[model samples]
Target: MSSSGTPTPWSYAFIRLLFRFVLKIFYGSIVVEGTHNIPKTGRPCIVCANHSNSLTDALLLVTSIPPKDRNMLRLTAKATQFGQRTFTSWLIESAGTVPIKRRKDYVEGSVDNTDIMQHLMEALELGDAICLFPEGMSRYHPTIAPLKTGVARLVSDVLTRNRNNPDFEISVLNCSVTYMHRQHFRSDVLVSFHPPMTFSPKTHPELLAPIDYNNIRLLTTQMHEQISSGTIDSPSWDLVRVAKLAARIYAPLGTRMSLGDHVRVVRAFLEAFKAAEDGPEVDGEHPEEDEKTPAETAELAQLRLDLRTYQDQLARWGIKDDRIRRQPLPRHTILSRIIVRLTWSLCLFSISFPGLMLWVPVFLTTFYAVHNFKKTGPIFDTWDEIAQYKLIYGLMSGLCVWFGSAVVTFPFTVVTFLLVPALMWMTLRWLEDAVSAFRAFSALVRLLLVGKPTLRAMHVRREDLHARVMRLAVETLRLPEDSEAYFARHGGKEKGRVRGPWESGSRYFSIKRRRKRDWNETLRLYDVVDYPKE
Candidate 1:
């Protein structure tokens, strides 16, 4: 046991501390409940959670398990991951992950080996918890996959073999991972822990048998219900799900949609009605194709239409359909992301470099100044957006060549003349960022000084924006006038802006979000409206 006794080890404490740091720093949350329901001192236990995303759910749970029971948490992981040379793979093993080989063709002895059973029992007999995803594989959509009997049978097997520890317990948490933008920044995740499933049998004559499993089935059905409804409100943010629900709520208000905006609308339907396992096939009866409530059927029809439109637009913009569909950056393809990142990170590491490394500074400076110019946002039609990145890369590659020439031919007059200006430009950009950072810090201080007044001013503005946006949306949608009615009630709000502005007394809000690139250039490319020169 690494550290689960009364006196915990420095290593265990360090691990726990490290988990908190990582969760806060890198875009995750531990929104679990009913942790207390799992006994601190009990018989063998198994923990199960829904699988979504690549590794976020398991990693979060692994990091959150109490150290007293840390060693006991014998987690199961994919075999290939264990073979990888990555630090995460090594960490997985060191943290005591059991390798579950993906079996292709099942043979007599090949099915669930004795060694695996031995490992699981050894872990439980020693009073440790085993964690696993019963679904066995991750899914992209937000819904609980079919519950496997592995957990149920595992508990049954453990009890039959041990025969002695009759009170063994098992816990199952139905978790949903909602991504904001799969490939974007500050993505949110949500975790919900349902009540535990204690082993008990309804038919066992021996009054005292394995922890009640009849109780467990009831628990799982209950979990499926909560997750299916999207009602488990954990503190963890569901980035993609949130946006979708927001879009559904806000779309009716005439908010012109973006591709991201469209996805959200489709996502709500997917979450609510997208059945995972196909139900019994319908015969000739063919249940009403439009059986959905009139409003729901209309929404579903609209989502399908919107998705077609969004995809066509992406195609029209020359984005290869395959690429947009396969946007999740692969763990192996990480070098590509890193290269693109370090093309920028050359600047980060340069700040700590002994001297102003020539290549790094110039690259960073031009990149920053160019990006800042997009504060007002550039009108990049899809082609223009694609072209902009390529141009930047060409410039960066050229700059790198120049720096290389200067370094290889030091003291060469011609090289120095060109290198000197580029070097100066880089240095100037760095200086500007440094200055900007300081000014930002000072502005924060001033905001603090004028906190209440500034807050009040912001509140007023937000309220005004909200009111105007509502008025505009209602009018655009051609809804019958009612002073007491709202866009939310008419089902018009879209793209995640709710009447309740994530704060109380919110004064104003903007539908005009200024992301670095105004991908919606189509909307504003024209200087004047149809009624121009009025």
Candidate 2:
């Protein structure tokens, strides 16, 4: 950081590239959208996102933005992070993080953020971008927690600063980051940047006063609405699980979806569930529409039951959902596929063997890191923490070991350091293929051991369940029954389109209640704002 407590340009660039490289190593794929929505450096910007994964969320947000603006992007972290005595804390400080104390992180009247607020204001005055998670804390959950008012408060303060200078503007970008499996190694991630939510003292005068509690509350509510729309917001993990299963079954056999498309389908299912439970009010006059409602409701209930049963059966046999085929493959075809997969894996393994040998120290460093994490008093607790520890420890320690060796073996130092990362990448690819091949081989063994009648019965049950799921989804989501048609209509070459039930302003799908009960009470016990009773 420079003397002004902002990240120097070169330091910021180096850190940004380092993060990008680590991300490439960690996640299998990273899909970023809406880069054009990022605000220019001339304006003060606030990049707010939903927090699900712990440290990686921040790393993803920083790397998703354009490189030119990254040097000016100052990330806001929790005060607790600043107080930590670790290498991560040192890096956070050097990266010019503005630390603010949360109410929950401290006892009442223990500490104040007066100084932090002043520092943030100073950074904004220079048109530096500020990024933070409005949820206040990172979590491992399905639904987004109720957002804290920090974002609104900060915007109000910035607006107050710009009251006298009408030319100055503030841009708030809601960049929601989603993960396929947050804890899994080599999972996919999607970072989407929504259009900037701009504010100016001249236009939004009501928000200019820092002490305007009403306006601040309204702004926070608006921010939550926008952020929620971009996330996979549901009531519970159970709902998320069911929705994902339903989406998978709804697709055609051998169909694969990109991360964005998968997120859209899952969220749509979640929203449909919410809408069905809410059961919109309808006049008693329309008998035909009324009769259709209960039949669809019954169909959904049956679908859920079948899905749960199938899930339990798969669990019993230690089989994955994706391994279930609608039609059993010919024996020769299955055997040939398995043979080809193992042959390819073996060839790649041979190629990566030498590189792995050269990076023995790095492997040893990672082993130690894992051992430390498994201790009784481990520093890391969650999956995100463990993954981050492995990455950080491996990079830092590997570099130190290589640098020390380079001094003694002076001639080939540059080539040695350069070769390590390439070797690491090659090893990663070989491991992925080897694991996939092993799974295929295991599935093949199961097929051979299990009798044909039992396997055929399972296949028949899956096809029936899939058909039911698609039929229900078509009625509720208002999409074509055929998977290809749905994809062609909404899944464009670029952005994945998601149409909400109410997007068309149609009341046809909204069913009248057969029974009266409050659905909002059934929601998860998170801090989310209450939904109105239908």
Candidate 3:
């Protein structure tokens, strides 16, 4: 097999058959819209969407397309997913899959996005249709997250390579997959496709290339509008109405809502449609930020206003977050895939109490919280960053507890009590980079179990998984850390500079500019978080 280990045509066919059976058994009345929008045939193009469920969406896409078009689909599955099964892993590589390390918190670690961009450009040059999810991962909220500029970069690179010849106009079809029960079983799964989106000038340099933050913003707005089409069917809810509703909802949320927040509202509105169509009765778990004590409510209110302002800017561009109801997907629901994770702090708090310790859970959740800006599959995104490692971080702390108890059992009980866990914590902190690869294997298995179809316990191999993670680390992250621009974030250089969410010190404007600044554009606000470092 080729080194990347993409699945072969036969393997993909098998995978498609297998998943089709699963969909038949579990997902009923699957409805796929916008079929007319798919080009009968075209140059290698991009597929972008917001991620909600798991890689099952990949199966849906592959299954829906004809075999002739199947080969044309060189899906960019996250390298972390390579270990579901030995054959499955092999199949992924044989499919001519490129092992891109998009988000660093992956099992194999982060990717060199720049290299991935280069690889993607070449794939497009071959007239291969490259499928990608702009959102990084499945989001918990009703809305989409802010996207990384990597997509813009990919679009830019492909067009740049074909600058001399613009005969092949790129076809980017935005598909919105809505589920009846995103967390339940035997639900309806509906996927809607949109007319292919093309850059304005039909050129790369001034139009598509020289990608900037605003370009990233514009792309996000259009995406918000596109995905919302099939998902949101409200006749009255034009871009204007949605914009106004979003403003009202966000008006009181407070000023801290980043551009990401505005994006999420649009994402949420779309998700609400998916939930309404596919989900059973998903009462959001997180308490309404809009409803809280006076001080807290005011804080949320201000954040809400900031989000509306962000949306308003896009509305001015006439970027429509409109709705065009088409047929919905089949009926089914998402199963409870939530492997509830506990943090180390909670563990410490639990063990500290006697009776409560007796009732504490024996096993902590092992899943990692990977955040992808915008994703295609429910789980896999074009780029992903680990938002919170509290899951695995707590796992490490548990080991520290057992090892700590044994290492100092003989003497100095107090010293063991005080120093062991702390020492263990500090020591393990250094291992974060080293153990990251292995941790990804554990995370992948969890994702497959909770997200992918097939409920029986999976026979996943760890060492094999670890090896792939290692390969991924070498191929996706270790190398690209030196290259990709997306990997580059502003780290504060001076003493007064504030720490960024990801870095030890993120740069933001001092409080001096707080009142006068435009929250969206000002350095005083709009701080970005990196995958891990943030």
Q: Kindly report which residue stretches of model 2 are placed more than 4 angstroms away from their true locations once superposed.
A: 1-8, 83-85, 210-212, 252-257, 275-298, 358-381, 400-414, 485-534
Residues 1-534, model 3: lDDT tens digits: 012222236756666675565454334335565667765444556777666554555656766666554354667777775767644466567666666565555546545667767877766666566777777655433345565556666666666666667465666778877653343222345677788776423553554555565766676667767775545323222332333344223222222222222333334443333332332423665455422345433433443344344345323332211100112112231112111222332443344344222112312322222232233343323222221122223334455654556566756566656655454433322222222223323333333434332211111222232233233234422322221121223211212222356432222222211211111211111111111110
Tens digits of per-residue lDDT for model 2, 362-450? 66887687677657442223444655676777778767765766665669878867765566666765655555556556666666666
Clash counts per candidate, in order, are 28, 0, 83
Candidate 3 global lDDT: 0.44
All candidates' TM-scores?
0.47, 0.81, 0.42
Ranking by TM-score: 2, 1, 3
- Better-scoring candidate (TM-score), 1 or 2: 2
TM-score result, candidate 3:
0.42
Candidate 1 on 303-377: residue-level lDDT in tens? 434444443443333322222222233444544444454444355335625334544654565456446544644
Error of 2 at 149 (Å): 0.9
- Quote the positional error of residue 69 for candidate 1 in Å: 8.3
What RMSD value applies to candidate 3? 24.8
What lDDT score goes with residue 287 in model 1? 68
TM-score of 2: 0.81
Instruction: Choose 1 or 3, whichever is better by lDDT.
Output: 3
